[model samples]
Target chain A: MELELESEGGELVVPVELLYGITEELTVTVVLPFRDPFENGRLGSVGLRAKWRFATRFSPGRADAVAAVGGITVPRSSADGPQAGPVIIAGLAAGRESRRWYYFAGVRTAIHLADEGNDPGEQLLLNVAWGVRPWLTEYLAPDLVLLVEASSRTEGRTRVNGQTVDASGGEVLSVAPAFLLSYRNVMLKGGVQIPVWEHLNDAGRSEDVRILAALELHW
Target chain B: MNRTLFVLLAGFAFGVTPAAAQDAQRDSTEQVAPAAHPDIVMRVDGLACPFCAHGLERKLDALEATETVEIRLNEGLVLLYLRDEHSVSDQALTKAVTDAGFVVRAIERHPPTEGTD
Candidate 1:
């Protein structure tokens, strides 16, 4: 998936992670995250994941079946912005592999707690991934994947810093194009997330380009 | 008749040139020494997919055990080249990778290959 520790400008914004699933399928995941966007303070939270693996029942090869995952962000974190809580979300995902090609798709809706009395915290997100690992030889291989996702957001009228502005925001559309190139087990992942479209009352200064990079190793 | 003679001489020169070059290369290859580093093979669990593979490598980098790292995805194992083997042991290496979020299935001496020291 295309995730980022959202860093725009050079402000003290909480680093956002489009990151998830540090563990394998059908297992519980524990995420201890600290920080919130614009809070300038440490916000701590945890999560749990349960995969369904449904497609496993009918796969001809080593299919991962299907998965249903649900988790909640505790109220202790920021009660505002993208890291809203107490939030709950459930997702249904399915994946399959045919030789060199690996495919996956999932849809999720997060019910975040109310914010600014207008509910800018409630949203729904859907994402999909396709990857190809071409094995050139016994000691060399390359992995490539693409992801597409969209989210619906709610923004209430409010004032930031000190501007009495009527920020009647609604829904926003986002798209991310990601690429991962791997040499054997060591991989380099990079992606760019752009704001496609959104029903914003006033998307102050509009959004800017965001990016991320990470190195992964497999044994 | 002159063109044919020239062609024959050219063919003869080309054939002898490759043989002479091959003889010299073989002599140099035979004189080179083997590598000095040993192989570290580690079998691990919780490494069944791409996401974990990424995170596992990040975790392994945190250890700073040796310099170079080689991961075998299909074989579900990792190999490192350490200057001194004591810097990381079987159990210690397993715990580091696991703490970064992976399971250690096996740890053993990698069978030496022809050029390893």
Candidate 2:
């Protein structure tokens, strides 16, 4: 679930996701995010994500992995906006994990597949996160991990009927801090994103804060 | 709202210490090779939570030889049960765990003990 307050309005999202590991090298996930912007509630979008691990290096105390992620997001409701259809996303992620700390970096981009005379904003995403776990134990204890991340998004211009409507789409950055807690097959994570910088065209809303909470059940 | 988030961050900063880490490494040598219906135990690092450990389970379960996979979070151990007529090498175990984003400190193979299904 996510709650975001922006200069224009507020939005809430409840997303259900199904993830499966097809093999040691491949994984797939499907997500359906329910969205509510103010009084109207509707299906936001459907998305599919696939990740392929290309390289992994392991040692006694540390491990590093590199993977490529590809996905597609399709808007489900007209409330989405013009230039809304299927957007293909691709990215590469690299991470290092140890007993105490984990860090990851990734970059992603959304390429719009829209009809003629409709221009939707393409999105670019870059993110880096670092997390640390305290209290390594020999018995059953709830594991807790604290994380901090920097996320940046760059949006292109929006055009309607082949005409530019909002040119103020550029870049926005946020600093998010989060925590994870888990016992066995269940995990919970919560965080808040605070805007740190912006260089945008007039088309995008300035966000106040983004609150997030997620739960995962693994078999 | 920002203050609330900052307070949450500070709360975490003061909550725990790194001294609680589970860093026990077992000796892999002197262990017998796995028999039919093998039971494999491995010590792992970076298994801080169930979500992270789930990756290891998924990878191990994908093998045709694996019948079941179990993770003991606190002990940082993964146990795999193999079907009869199939076996997994230590190198394969290491690669699978590493690909799942964790490190294997040691791996041991054993015959299925009595009462262990």
Candidate 3:
């Protein structure tokens, strides 16, 4: 079980995820998110995702792996939010984990399909992260890890009734510093993303700093 | 005649006591056998966090022969103590670790030596 909360641009989003491991290398997840844009808060799109770790290498206390993730988000009614059609998502990620250090890089793309006359912006996201463990500890002991992540997001323009929405999309780059604390099977993590650069279209709202936190449990 | 019978009964009682005591001692020793050194030790990779390592613990514990498990995260080592008279194969152990999303770097077996008890 995973419960995540994020505050961005005066909007609050809460996403709950349930994940199941089918095999050591395969996992499935269901995401249900609730978003509040300062008025008429409601449930957002529902998403289903599958992750497959296809390749791995190991040496001593270190390991590296590559994985692919694919998912689909089913849109809710127009009253839910701006999303009016289903979205397809695909991504590839590779990472390495060692006793004292970790690193990961990934890219994801979301294609929003048109529904009726409303077309939402398609998005591309790129991310990189590095982490370190402050102190080495044995299992069942409290452990803490610090990480820094950088991400860039770009979105294509949206069109409604065959007319392009001038302020619909643009690009932003952000960096986040986060921490993860774990004990046995439970983990808590949080981060704040600070936008460093932005290029929005005319009348587009500039990106703001976002705060995120999550709790995860495994049994 | 009574005196002779009493002496014979006393001799029999004395003989049975030591044998029963020996049996009890053997039983106690057998009970402590499982507490000896772990039968198998595995060096697992990617055990960087306690939360992620918990899945590996659960997977290894599910093996049929496993009785108990101990993990040393800093060293990426997992110790398995098996049930008496039970053994798990290397293939099974490797699969268990792999399924838990980790790699088995190396495995060492220290099966009990015969007559060491």
Candidate 4:
């Protein structure tokens, strides 16, 4: 579940994801999003994602490792129907994991679809995160991971109703502090995204705070 | 003859005969042996998230002769216990880990345990 609060209104999102591992290097994911209740709640968007891990290295005796990751997201959310035009999202992620620490960096972009709201602008995203396990145990007690991340999303100019709208796109930077707990095969994660900076055009929308919480299960 | 008779009487009181005791010992001896159920332990990379760990577990469990799959997140260890008459190769283990989006660092074969039931 996710929620974003802005000057205009608030949005609530519930997303369901199904992922399968096809090969050692490839994975496929399907995502279906349920719309916000306050904003005419309905089926929002359906997305298909694929990721390939092309490189990896592990230490012989320790829990230290690194990997290179690449993936793409194909979105089907347009004004025409639920599964019409496609929006392309491509990104690269790299990360390292050790006994007590985790770090990651990623860059991605989203190409907007036609007739998707009033905005048809491209979005560029960059994110970096660092996480640490404060308490480590092998018992049934869940491991607690504290994470801090900084993310920036910048949007290009938009075309609304066939006319270019210069003021309809902007940039927002946010810092999120999150926590994850793993119990058995279930992981629970929650965080709040606080905007640190914003650069908006005259008519661009501004956001205040956004919150995210997700539950993952492994079969 | 008297000692043997007394021992047999004692065994009957305790719910065990000489032949039954030998069978029990043999059954236990077969448990921790490699011919029973073999266990494989692998040190894995990127067993960080529960999601990924779960995926690896599913893959390993799907393999033949797999009795149980256990993941030690803190240690980044994947343990697979195979039933009797089942075995997995090193390549299969590596492929399972990689398919689940992880890397295999090291693999070790441990003697089967007595408590796999």
lDDT of every predicted structure (CA atoms)? 0.51, 0.70, 0.80, 0.65
In candidate 1 the C-alpha lDDT for residue A209 amounts to 62
Clashes per candidate (backbone, < 3 Å): 17, 6, 1, 2
Interface RMSD of each: 16.5, 7.4, 19.3, 17.0
Q: Which docking class does model 4 fall in?
A: incorrect
Residues B1-115 of candidate 3 have per-residue lDDT tens digits of 4355335434433323343344345446545655768888898877777778878887987898887788888777999888888888888898889888888888888854322
Instruction: Specify the poorest-scoring 10-residue window by lDDT in model 1 chain A.
Output: A54-63
Q: Candidate 4, residues A1-219: lDDT per residue as tens digits? A: 111222213555666678775765576777767555345656556677777766666563223333344344444445124332356777888877655787888888887666444546788999999999887655234567899999999888777667787776788899999987765455667788899999877454676787776665544
Docking class of 3: acceptable
Query: Which pairs of residues have clashing backbones in candidate 4?
Result: A24-B98, A24-B99
DockQ of 2: 0.19
Candidate 3: DockQ? 0.24
Q: At residue B11, what lDDT does model 1 achieve?
A: 43
lDDT of 1 by residue, A1-219 (tens): 221233445432232233344344345544444343335556455554455444343222123547788877665534224433366878887776433566777777776565434243345566666765554122323445444434334444444333434655456666776765554334456677778876676657466666655443333
Which lDDT value does model 2 have at A89? 96
True contacts kept of 4: 0.28
Error of 3 at B42 (Å): 1.6
Model 4 stretches with alpha carbons more than 4 Å out? A1-8, A37-40, A60-85, A115-119, B1-40, B49-51, B68-70, B73-94, B110-117
Better of 1 and 2 by TM-score: 2
Off by over 4 Å in 2: A1-9, A37-41, A79-83, B1-41, B44-50, B54-106, B109-117
Displacement of the residue A146 alpha carbon in candidate 4, Å: 1.1
